[model samples]
Target: MTRRVLRTLLPAAALVWTAAVGPAAAAVPLPIDAPLCGPAELERLDGLQADLDAKAAAGEAGRAQYWYVDPRACRLSVAVLRGAEDAHTEGFVGAALAASALPAPTSLTEVDEPVDRRIARVPAPAQRGARAAGTLHGGSAIYSGTSGLVYECTSGLNNYRPGTTTTAGHCADAATTWYDARGNRIGAVTDWRYPGTDWAVITPVAGWSLPNDVLGSTVPVARFGKASLGEAVCGRGATSGTRCGSVTAVNVTVNYPDGLVKGLVRSSQSGGEGDSGGPVYDGGTGLGLISGGASSGSPTFFQPLTF
Candidate 1:
């Protein structure tokens, strides 16, 4: 009887479910005409949905705040600012779904404000090791002073170049010089792209090299691209370490206080104040960097690499 129970349990335990959220995952970009709710409306939200998207792209003052499909809730959600609701946004969405003849599991969310998740963040209890580390790896703590916040952040992917790595473009904007957890001088910012697309390329000085490995893991990025729906992903931050969640939406536009940022990804994982520019990955493949999140719902938004 014991042997029989063990045999049954062993097979059940061994039956694991997995998806290769790597290069293949990137290949499958979110459909252009995806429904507002979930996968049920693929290729159907087109034509009539144009006005709705336009409103979402309107940015800070626009009636519609954001639009994305929630796979967990299996619906599309359009978030409007708490006090900024207009009938046109709702009517347009309804008309599009009606024309598509699909059961629209769609709803609108009201958020207090957009989450500006740049590396120039609010201060938190300082974590050790951010003083300096001559050898910086992905997800390692980085110290770069911003105007008001004495913030530390996690490093992003290291480029194929000899001594270069990437972080939040806003991070480069925060300070002229960057330091590592051990207080070692890391290097200088080479180029920065923020607001529109958030990324920065850093060229470390002599004696410092940006390694390919993540700080806490043996695996490093072999490739990078857009994240796919339902793909399992993880984000690494100086504050959060590593948090795993499913890629819930892509091709998302976030209306940040700085400006309207287009082309972001949303996940269920959570990060803290100093988590900006952290690495988001699937297996060994890089996915994105932490952008910001809402005050509620606790979603961690990331900036996907354009390739």
Candidate 2:
């Protein structure tokens, strides 16, 4: 698994451009005429994904490492690991595409390499000496287990049930207890979904209260909702801090070396290690949890909260 830190730092060049072009045009660019998928299409896509998974598990076809609906192209796309595609895979893709009654994939890019999850080894620089910034707030530092085998992550949201909260499932094991950055015992994993949907719920120990707002910001989160294309979104993580970006696509499935995850929200925002399980929100509404992202200047994917 990988962790990311969600901080937004503006470059000097960007500041200069913003001043020269005026704030109006400096806004994040929206996608042009991007097709939006309705709830029904999303359901159908899920059904088709199940069939593909079954076929792969049965050894009847090559494994489709990842599959997702690209609303911008109004089609579904699947990614196969390089050197894994064969006649069986092609046939499986054909049948799945035909069964969905949707447009074919716009492209069939082969994944040349495995998706690396080594970000867990990279420590967050902000984790040290800034005890004041390490309070238990949304986007604050979180971890499961004690030292040595600990898995670090970011707090996502505060559930309505007082001490209950959520984060990326990959960050917490059901058998392990969780703690805050200050070494205070916080909670334990109550439930989790991974290798499919990446989400987990943590129930805090006695006397701990969940906050309604993310740390270091006034953005309030009351409810969860689906992200629309072109929507402006922001995320907060312990490693990256907080960064704002635009929604590029939704209902995306990514193929990671560990396994596959579906129904993700893709954004132009960048994230680094320790940002996983952080909150992805727009204004006051919660949208999703940061799953993973590339090194830099690349899109990051989030597990949608509505799922």
Candidate 3:
């Protein structure tokens, strides 16, 4: 029954988040032309981090947390309940949790924060903008290049050939072209499979060298086991960031805008735009990529990494 459902549904939903509403294509490496953040922006992010630390210190024990970004301000942020006892530590670690099925985000919006209470507001990008780099939504340091049209989320690692790193497929679909901050072509999409599988491996037209800590310090890619229903899993992505959720269903089939792919795992966690190709794993084992999810619901689907 589970296999039957998954075989039918996972592919159509591939471009759900970004395709539903978002920006355009790839560009240069992030952080290069990225303007240094000002004191006010730094303070705001610091406070958010402090608040998360406070919660963790207060013993709020859960693998979930909050994520916020103001594309207008070019600010990306995350808040995790402190002392998160997980062995995974690639930045964007906090985004792995905190997706709520409540009031859903319909469009790509920034988060704003009030002086009091933990209020997150989305900031509008300034007229003169640059790239935004930070830990990935899947717990690694990541740099994103801005193409005026879209934000290209780039990672410094790849699972296919260890040591090969590049950006997400969503970025490719959105980008007209890609380059290094130095204004050099890095690579274009040699191949990409969306709705079917979240993983898109790009063969750089030229050799590309990536930073080691792009997402977080080096954490080896994990291995996976056949998942069981109701299994607990931890995951991270370039866009939606990092999060932890349980397997809501196994072998569930989904329909994406494109063709279909199989071996899906579903979760109740929330993932959003930019997080499309993130990795979902069980502790030390890798599972899949962020396939697609209900923009306003709890069903987060992943295309198994193995497939």
Candidate 4:
């Protein structure tokens, strides 16, 4: 089932959380320029962008690499394999978009990047002295003994429900029950999804509560939203603390070591092991969940909340 469908089946209260203008520690404003498209035009551009993403997900070769609505350029940001850029490809895209009955995006921005790539799950860091905390926050040390994992990972955005929290769904595979740094019982997995998407929700075990905040940062997750192109977003993993970087692309398909995952957000931020399922947010709005990286210090990738 789709994430949206699963969400709708959940109790309305299960999805409750508050996020507003929370924190801007890493947020960067877009450059000054007239918008590429007006309201009506933006609608068409967005619709076309969605169509392009759908095609890419369906394995349509030469479908403009991958795409997302670049609000800053007021265009559809696209990229192609080093050798696949050609008029025929662009023309093919244009022909497909014509059926939308809307003008094309203000422009199609081609980024200089490779089409094929590899990434691995942000591996958990070496064991650290477990220091227990009275309350857990994003970036707090957490571990699960469910899957023979000897490493621990960081916690993620919390308060999905009054008594629940979240993390990478892969973490759930390693943990049926979660524990805090101090070895406190945090909770157990309520639901999780991976591969196509990477995320999980955990209900706090007894004697604990999941709040909507991150450790070492004033920003509290008061809302959930997208991290726009060129926007700076911060992610907190147990080992990396709070790492921040600009988003390079969204709606990206990544070939992870274990499987191919689609619709991930890619950024320049670095994430360490033990940070799986950590939260990536733009100011007060939650953006995505850390999925993996190319290396220990390579560009970081995440699962957009909506994806």
Q: Give the number of the best model, judged by TM-score.
A: 2
Residue range 1-307, candidate 3, lDDT tens digits? 0100011113423211211112222221234335645666645544444444444333341332333332223333232223445533222232222221111111111112101110011222232423232112233322233234434343423534443444444444555344443334445555555433445554444344433222432455554456655678755654455667897555443333233333466777666644555566665565665656655424576656553
Tens digits of lDDT, candidate 4, 208-243? 656788887797789888776779889987777788
Question: Ranking under lDDT, best-scoring first?
Answer: 2, 1, 4, 3
| Cα RMSDs, all models | 12.1, 10.9, 21.8, 12.8
Find the 10 residues in a row with the least total lDDT in model 1.
Answer: 1-10
Off by over 4 Å in 1: 1-64, 69-76, 83-106, 111-114, 118-133, 146-149, 160-162
Question: Whole-model lDDT, candidate 3?
Answer: 0.41
Stretch of 10 with least lDDT, candidate 2: 14-23
Give the C-alpha miss distance for residue 83 in model 4, angstroms. Answer: 13
lDDT of each: 0.63, 0.65, 0.41, 0.61
Where model 2 places Cα greater than 4 Å from the true spot, the runs are 1-31, 34-50, 55-65, 80-106, 110-119, 122-135, 160-162, 295-297
User: Which has the greatest lDDT?
Assistant: 2
| lDDT, candidate 3, at 121 | 18
> Rank by TM-score, descending?
2, 1, 4, 3
The true-versus-predicted C-alpha distance at residue 173 of model 2, in Å, is 2.7
In terms of TM-score, which candidate is stronger, 1 or 3?
1
TM-score of 4: 0.61
